[model samples]
Target: MKKIYIEIKWAFIYSITLLAWMLLENTLGWHQERIADQWWLTLLFIPFAVFIYLLAVREKRRRVYDRKMTWPQAFLSGAILSVFIALLTPISSYIINNYITPELFFNAMDYSTKNVGMTQSDANEYVLLTTYLWQSPIGALAFGLATAAIVALFVRKK
Candidate 1:
């Protein structure tokens, strides 16, 4: 439990750093400008990505006896992170749906209805699918694993 807390703390740190980076870069300059609702959504990914990396390490350490954890540890850490992120995915989506961009639903529906090659019915179906994708916890976990694996392969110490 203590270790999970520590890892979550690190994850928050990682998430905040990501937010700071984006703020610095102006990529997520929406909140400051008051024209954005998905800033929270963007920010949510930061800790999620970090959590995946850290948890993957936890996974690795759990299986290994060596004092130093290895690549497999990193890989599994990502998987663990992914599951956690998935579990918490609702918090962000709920915010987005209820507050951040309530209009997003209609707006996206409108755009897709007009812009895509698909029929309105098909477009609506796709939109719903995309919404569900955003809602899915498993997707988050899988992405976490992928991102963690990439980062681990390059970032882990030799």
Candidate 2:
């Protein structure tokens, strides 16, 4: 359990790091100016997810499995870490959307209107739907589990 706690701690720290990076980008207006319509920014989620799973599994292997962890153990550790991440997502999303980048929604709506050829009502609906999906804990759970399942395969030692 100590190993799991440590992994969860790291996961929390990583989440904060990601939130800070996002806030910095938004504060600089990068999302609005440069990447508004680009999907590249979505790539950022991969590394964070990979690191969370990899580090968790590695730590578990090192401390608990004598550096020879089985797939089940690796998967379990990664899944547990993902659960922590999912639990933390709502709070982080709230802080980021409400406090850090309240203008993000407007920017997104504008982008949708200009780039996606969306009507005002359609853009508004798009933002609201996507935001709700992104912030939804159910989505987080599904994504976390899938990420854990995939990343565990690579991180497992034995």
Q: Residue pairs in steric clash, candidate 2?
A: none
Off by over 4 Å in 1: 10-67, 129-135
lDDT of 1 by residue, 69-117 (tens): 5567566555555566666666645654565445555555565566545
* lDDT of each residue in 1-158, candidate 2, tens digit only: 67677668867876787688777677666666865633576566668667766776777788878989777877787777777877787887788778887777788888889887999998897788456646556766777778778877887775
Best by TM-score: 2
Tell how far residue 141 is off in model 1, in angstroms: 1.3
RMSD of 1: 6.2
RMSD of each: 6.2, 2.5
Q: lDDT score of model 1?
A: 0.55
Query: Worst 10-residue stretch by lDDT in candidate 2?
Result: 34-43
- lDDT agreement of model 2 with the native: 0.74
